[model samples]
Target: MGPPAPGDADDGTGQRTGAVIVVAGVALFATALLAGAALAPDVGAAGDDASGTLVGSHGGGAGLHERGSVYLLDGREIAWRAGDTDSYFDVTKLDNGSVMAGFMQSGYDECGPYESPCAHTGFRIIDPNPDSGADPEITHEYSFPVRSEKNSEVHDVELLDSGEFLVTDMDRERIFTVRGDEITWQWNASQRYDAPEDPTRTDWLHINDVDVIGEDRYLVSVRNAHQLVVVARGEGVVEVINEGDPESTRGDPTLLRQQHNPQWLGNDSVLVADSHNDRIVELERGADGEWTVAWEIYAAEGVNFNWPRDADRLANGNTLITDSLNKRVVEVNRSGETVWSYNTPEVPYEAERLPEGETVGGTSYADGGGDTTTIGEGRDVPVLSFLLVIVQTAVQTPFWFTEVHVAVTLVSLVAVLVGLGSIIRARVRARR
Candidate 1:
């Protein structure tokens, strides 16, 4: 006949059939839930190897067209870049054909109580072309030391002709020049503008860029302030190019909202990536001393830009744009025609077209060594890692739990019931 009933047991002691199954189900359920959650992908983790070809019609002159590889801050991969720091903020091509980058890590106590929570922020100049089988050489390195109570993270760095470095200190609301380890010049935002409403606001000015416009003048993009300020090295603030109030966008073309990369385009005109406005505007100061939009590119003109963060005027009068949210870098001509484009696997913060004949990692692309061999078989979503991230985030920061976590939990519950049923049947058969 069939196996023994639930109550039957070889030891002569009747099994607690209901309790055993219930407990087994609960235990299995818990285990599966944790396992699944642990296996989920980590969204903050680095992305896979760069893949995809450059698209669009690449025309323009010998130097106007993008000849060399472009440098970018791959947002997704910066967190866990091997042998590197926590985050990559900016990447640019140095005059010596090297790559200069800014990186930062958090949760360090070296800066002490006066500084922000993050530490180990620094900039490095890397040799993109190294010997065969050799790693990229870091020729120059400088980590920000805690010199003042205003220790902050660096977002942008430019090597000055005088062998000095200009850097933006986000937390300190200042742009400072560093000669070796000492701060030679600095301009604090608080000294000129009102402090942000929130006293703890570290990114009040959100100074994203500091470009030397003239002998002693600097063009600064005060993102949070929704304006561009031109400051003299010693004389202090000189001009403020207001882009209107960030809260309300007026029809005035002069007003900017959350802009970045204000570069002098010559003839008293400025080219800015009007980020929040979803356009790139060329502002020109007329004889009336008022700034007006000379030209612009918007989605309505069949041009697609998703929160572009950086735009550089190329030698051929073309523009290289870092389409941040689109996860791509695009080069467009003066007529708003897309000439060249590279689609990244993750968000790209900035894109700098390297000088002619300059390449990174021996390739003129962002493929990180021209090895397009798919990493992890070209899987876009790390499902297993995401599950683990979800579980960990749920446990550590419950507020981070999302609908995906709920779905995983429900699936685990079903698995628990199935496990319990199988165990009950197997135990009954063994008793017989």
Candidate 2:
């Protein structure tokens, strides 16, 4: 509605049409996900229009190789219908074979036309019948009030088994849980987070991702704080399971700054996407609350992460990782060797492993530097534009331009009539 937040990147050198086409593909790729511990049915093989699967039975190399990454699985990557946008922020799968993708519009700092980008309010739901050819639609948009004011956004979404949802509000620096449509609980960093104000200003907790570690414990990633904070569920006590002080770290000091997503592996250990450090670290907590690194992937330089966002451990011990900036998903065995890999059609956010070996992921990108739209803002055009995508996917139509052209023609006809009426009135007045 108003001007988009500043500090957004828009070179304004690219073509609008090409950007839209690529954005559409990326949006579709973002909806796929990691099925639970069990393997998912091969929807792509069934010849369903909307169903697309990525099987990773390709590539090979023996040693702890780096250059020649092997793809051992035969994965299928299918394009979803048009207008399906993606995110690199959050991914939540529902019990009914549906998914809630956090971050409605991503990548762009500003908004305009089809290029409107917002924070985490936007989401897409995928049906169990992937072949139903139903395009995933974006809806149930949610955003924090202050975030919207400051142009901040949501970083992730977690679906609780109780049908509730938890989201990381980046701007507010807190975690919020939603029941039905209301915010049930929140943990604010400014007031409750324990930290020395002036000394650790650069390391102040910038809550990024949250995961349920136990009935009484929750794991959260604090980017700027440079720590994996373990907090009691529904309580205010926060303890650091990773780095404490910036000076006493084994690696770079910036590692504690702007850390990304974290996943709980078990009671005493967790996996974190240390984005700033360009690696994933497995941290273990001892009885005395001391933390140590158990194992780390790509900790040293020369590893391939561009900006890994989120990761999950599969039943078969494979780790499905979202390489956000690289626009790809890497599947690695327990030994940290690449077992399978899938390139995102565009920039991606989060990824998960499904019941079967297949992995679903969220793609992302910055939109144009023009008008960006959010929920309750922008012209009704985006609403209608998105609805058309739904119809096109449902009907399995190949030509979107044909449908748009007809709508434009009809609107132009009405404008012509209005103009003719005004011209006749001017003639009548001149005669008088």
Candidate 3:
């Protein structure tokens, strides 16, 4: 054509221009990632600010499992860890300096009816010798078998003065007590909810937590149903919070979406870790006998709560929280200000502070809270979402680098690539 275009081949001018465009695009994208993370609010100082020993249960599933353990932190340092199983959840330190931990492990010889190398889930008594700094001895274990380790784990266990152990069983969807080797008592959830033909085949009702709120009364957390039920020893179904039809998925999930540990404050109040909702809610029972949110905290340390799995109302009027995806345990005041915090290397299910222990009837939320909504609420970009899944399979990413950040970086990079392609195509056409 008439004297070739400007960047056609000015002594490698087209190649130089193309290289600059590509390089600039990459630089911009990387810059966005860094800047986005920098803007996201980080944790408060480090974990050492708080005193006393804090015990947390490390659960598997998201990342490299099988390395799960029940770890104890004395002040800022990790004093001891016991992980003889694939995952551990719901730990309680007894008065005898021993910790009773509920656990799940794979490849068990005692698989009941299932084949060998199946999953075994139950509670183990671990003598926590923190000073030794080694995996302590597992004194005793009470476990049974299941097919796979998907949702068949024993999520909770509580010891009574009567030499009985209460447990929440996901395998059979029931709250049961085991004395020695005998199942002393059990309340099957099938009585209230729609039952599947085979409970082991599917995770029908994810009954995650149970607490001995009263003398013979139990507070149960039905996770998938998004409701809590109180069952007395003799009474089948005394009362149901968030009441809904048993045939369906149940009540208004917007109230408590797939929640985890629920701490019963008293007869009329409870504090829950609203997991999928990404918040901690303190619900008060109204005079009309209905539950409503009295106080809620959606975020702390600037970053929003991501899939928070556990929360406890402390005696000192503070709330201990387990932000799972964020991989940290935080203690916040009624105003939602973080008082103390501990960052874990991987995801932890729950944590309980020592001394006062898990006492009953916690204080109510005097004042409401700050930050009514969560930061980076939902995923904003499709490409970034897909890439994150691939990246996460290899390494765990930071929680604060949220969906909004990804959208901006991806859009900017795509625009640059489009411009680069147009310029390269023009240069090729000019060469002819």
Choose the strongest candidate by TM-score.
3
Tell me the TM-score of model 1: 0.59
Candidate 1: deviation at residue 320, Å?
0.9
Tens-place lDDT per residue, model 2, 195-309, is: 4544212434556677776664667776765777777766754666555554652223433335677766665656677665556655666566655555556611113454466
Q: What is the C-alpha local distance difference test score of candidate 2?
A: 0.48
Per-residue CA lDDT of model 1 for 166-232, tens digit only, reads 8887666788988888989999887667776643345566677888777877888788777788889
The predicted structure with the larger lDDT, 1 or 2, is 1
Model 3, 157-248: lDDT tens digits are: 99987889999999999999999999999999998787989998998888999989888898999999899999998887788888765557
- When 2 and 3 are scored with lDDT, the better candidate is 3
Ten-residue region with minimum lDDT total, candidate 3: 366-375
- CA RMSD for every model? 13.8, 19.7, 4.9
Q: What is the TM-score of candidate 2?
A: 0.55
Ranking by lDDT: 3, 1, 2
Which portions of model 2 show Cα errors greater than 4 Å?
Answer: 1-74, 79-88, 106-129, 144-151, 194-205, 246-257, 299-303, 356-432
Off by over 4 Å in 1: 1-83, 107-109, 114-117, 145-152, 196-200, 243-254, 300-303, 356-432
TM-scores of the models, in the given order?
A: 0.59, 0.55, 0.83
